[model samples]
Target: MNLAMRRSPWATLTVLALAQFIVVLDVTIVNVALPHIQSGLGFTTDGLQWVISAYILLFGGFLLLGGRVADLLGSRRVFITGLALFGVSSLAGGLATSPVQLIAARAVQGFGGALLSPAALGILTITFEHGRRRNIAMGVWGGLAGLGGTAGVVLGGVLVDSLSWRWVFIVNVPIVIALVIATPVFVRPIAPHQGNRSFDLLGAVLGTGGLLAVVYGVVRAEPVGWSSAEVIGFLATGVVMLAAFLAVEARTTAPLVPLRLLRARALSTAGGALALNGAAFLSMFFLTAIFLQQVRGDSALRTGVEFLPMGGAAILGAVMATPLVTRLGTRPVMMVGAVLNVAGLLLLARVDAHGSYPTGLMPGLIIFGAGLSAIAVPAQIAAVVDVSHQEAGAASGVVQAFQQVGGALGLAIVSTLSTSRTTSAIASGASQSDGLTDGFHRGLLVAAVYAVVTIAVTFLSPRLAPSPEQIAEAAAVAA
Candidate 1:
């Protein structure tokens, strides 16, 4: 670590958090620019979904491997390599003139993100003491996760409207460059595990293949019905691959994911809640974005601006979570978040063709955003709370992978249901606006159901506090 980082760990954290912000920001920034990209590249509606799906596929699929690699190698090394690759991929994506080229670049970008995200989180875990300081850092990290998506929508809109859609991708180049230069100076290096240096090649292959197949199957289910042969084939293949992976992990001397980790109540329960949270919250963004632009006839810029309140609410909630968790504990805070999310989604379900923003959307967005911060912050903290330093990356990866898979699966289910509703309404002679509104409302109701389930699950989770070893280690490092 450089003098600056040694002097103030917060500076190091800022660099790491900014790196995370860029990766998370990329996830949604492309949403607002999809229309421009579709027109420019002459993409069909079916093909357009690939733009997002491609990134999600690689990111989710390779996350475990990336995290494992970080633990086996060094967090600093993986982080720098990932940052450079992401920057180059972003530049390539920005300059692409064909859908194929853009999609390929996006896949590469996802791989880079898979590498960067876990390593960054691991660094944060090892850097801060597992107490108030770490809690505050986690809150900031979680807030940025919420902030990134909200900011992405707004930034994508501004860039698309004021300049070109390409600017959305291009914007990453400078940020990546700055991060690359600063990372080595600010971040301390983590040593690899001495016990097992062997790579889990088969596990990596099976896990990645399985996740990719599953996400692909989910995305495909929308265009082709769930019962379609193509969807069935992909889902089957994914299941087999994943089953094989589990078998491999159970036998391997140096497994990519230690089976023992999943046995922990706090980690397991946090994973479940994170998955449900991702399903409801991520899909809400997608559904709401479409409703704002397609159904309500709002411009991209206006849609982006309107989401600012949600962003602010999310940040506020995340900031508040640290103190609340300190006072109340993780499970209670998570339950409260789930209840708030359900209320928000229920309110949003009342939206109609003629509904105004204040009554129909604003209240729900604000409440849901706050709930999002509440759940996400604590869940993430719980995932790595008592984990050994060597396993930090892997634990973080598990939580994130569940989140990605859940988001993909939830979006598919919701999209299929909503589209079916819209198609049925249109067939019955309802106007386009009314049909769309009806479909969106139904989707929101399903999301509310997801929130309800999350609340129920919170009761089963064990209440976990920072372990003594964790606090001692953190204190030693600080001293």
Candidate 2:
């Protein structure tokens, strides 16, 4: 069979985009169905957090290994395996009979996704020949990442509101099926990269373990209090394990992160900005939902609808920024985005406890969406800048893993910040609503900080990026 050397035609883009959508949509979809999921599964109070966290911790932690696997194995084969696992895991989660069953299934789902995301990106790299078609495919791919945020809100609400919470997982069934049927025909199988290189087993273990420990510590601190021995011990353990992973990487022959790849100013700045961007994106959606429903008395459906502005704006902003990146380069477009995000988040913080949705919430979401779109796309381009085809999967995987891990950290940190402020506000004898809004405001402040740091990082990004000539040359090197 001939390799799929050209970009995916319309039919291919549609299938691949849908595939990307299914994978990412899973990440945010469950959040909206938390209440329904809890009631259905008879979960313990803390079980809901686990439902989300288990998947995130596993998915984020394994992405680097997963990415490299796509490179070493054929991208097409890995993609198929990942998709099959995802479909099966979702089926299991949907049919879950007990709390343990659900939690375990969720972990399985996370593992499947860990494999799926990187493989999907790698497939795009292979299928989409460099140029306008590649840009559009990536835009669609990037847009779907934004779409996941949108689908999470609308689909979760509709699923829970209309049918059962299980449908959230079940909906993916058809989508996955479509992709499986489509990929073999549309995506030609590439040769397996049987380089002399060996797998980094130590790096995998250390990296995965270190991230899990950090996430565990962050989550534990919320319920156990900051001073609790469990929280402190977990936190300490995370730091030590992460440090050990770094040491191992430095000494290893074929390390997970080749030191040379870090030399590009574009990659470093984009990576740093990505961490902060993750903090801002994850924290805002969740924290705002809490403020809307808990403090301001909005229905679940209403709250979901309210976030449409952010989702829509993000898509629009991303579309608008693409042309600019082609003309102006990556750093400028992303820097502009970082500026908008910082301003918008700060504006969100100023929204009063008694503020109405149309006046306060709508504007905030719009600004944020615009800001998010601008930063996200160019940042993605920067992360994979000038990477050899052999390293395409690894490079993309690193960015994806950082994004997931950073998001996990943000949820924890924001939860803590909100709790502390809410406690202080309550102690000061403020009204219940006021105290709750105060907590949200404090969380937004932290989000604002994330945006600000991202801006500074964007400025640190090199103005120049690899030209179209250079990117096309990359594939030639691998050949």
Candidate 3:
């Protein structure tokens, strides 16, 4: 049979995008359902965070290794394997009766996503000839990924309000089933690359374990005082393990992360900025969900509906980003994005117990969404500035991983900040709603600060000339 089995490229792209869509969609789908999940599972406020944190940690931590595995074991095989794992885990999550069960399932789902995401991207890169067609496919892919993220909130709301919060996870089971069946029909099978196919098991374990420990420490600090021995021990353990991970990577033949990539000024700067951006965006969304439902007394459905405009604004920003970057360059676009994010977060910080959504959250939500997408596109481009073909995947993976890991870490810290302030306010004799609002304000203020720092980081991004080839390649790599 001919390579690709002579399958239509669009068909392959569709399959790949759908796979990616599920990966992105899972990130936010659970946010709207969080309240329902907590009530149903009787989760402690501090314990509830693990539902989201577990997924992001495993997904981000395993992502680079997943890509490397796909390269050695074939994209088609890994994609199917990931889909199966996701489907099984989603079913388990839906049926979970305890918080631990649900959290464990989410972690597995994250690992599956780690395996699925890169395989899909790898397939897309190989399927399309590297030029206009590939660029267009990647654009469609990028746009769809954003939509999937925004759509998750809406979809989760509908499912939670109408069916049950369990459906938020159950919904994925059918989708994964369909994707698995469709995979062979559309996605071309590539033979596993023949060579030294060593896996980085130690690095993956140490790195992921270290992050989990640190995030655990942060989460625990909210419930138990930060001075507690448990918190301090976890923090110390995480730091030492991370330090050890670096040492191992420096010596390993097949490292999970190539330390030399940090030497690329553009990659390092953009990666840092992307990490901060991820932190702000993820924490903002998590707090907004709680604010709308718990503080403002909105139904799950209403909260999701309220987020519609923000989602639309985000899509608009993504669509507009390419043209803006093409005309103005990455640095200017990034600066504007950073400013808009700060403005949005500041507006959101004004949310009060007495305020209405229209008067308080709507405008901020819209602007924040737009700013989030705007920064995202340019950062992706800047991260790849002057990168060679050989290092492109590694560089892209590094930044993307930073974004996910940053999001998980950010969520943990911000949740603690918000909870701490809320406790203080409530203890000070404020009304429950007022105390919650105060907490939300603090969290959003911190997100605004992160965005403000992002503005400064944009200056460090190297300028990539708007040449057609460079744009096309960078954009595709970004997707």
The candidate maximizing TM-score is: 3
lDDT of each: 0.80, 0.75, 0.88
Q: Is candidate 1 or candidate 2 better by lDDT?
A: 1
Per-residue lDDT of candidate 1, residues 346-440 (tens digit): 98888765689987789999999999989977777777777787676567667778777677667666766776787778889999888888888
Poorest 10 consecutive residues of model 2 by lDDT?
470-479
**Candidate 1, residue 292: lDDT:** 84
List model 2 lDDT by residue over 1-479, tens digit each.
34444324655666666776877788778777765676778974333456766677678777777777777887778888888888988989899988888778877777777776777776776676877677667666766666776878887777867888898889888888878887888877778777745768788788778777777677666567879999889888888888988888788877777656666776667667777787788888767866776677665677678888888888789668767777898888888888888888888898876777788878888998899878877777777756666665456566666777787777667767787777778889987788878888988999988898887888888875556654333222211
Model 2: per-residue Cα lDDT at residue 232 = 88
lDDT tens per residue, model 3, 1-479: 56456368998888889888988999989999888898999998778778998999999999999998899999999999999999999999999999999999999999999999999998888888878888889888987888898889889999989999999999998889999998988887888878878888899889999999999999999889899999999999999999999999999998889999888887887888888899998899888888888877788888888888888988888779878888888888888889999999999898786687787788998999899888888888878857888888889999999999988998899888888998999999998888888888998898888898898888777765466567668888978
Residue 52 lDDT, candidate 1, scale 0-100: 72
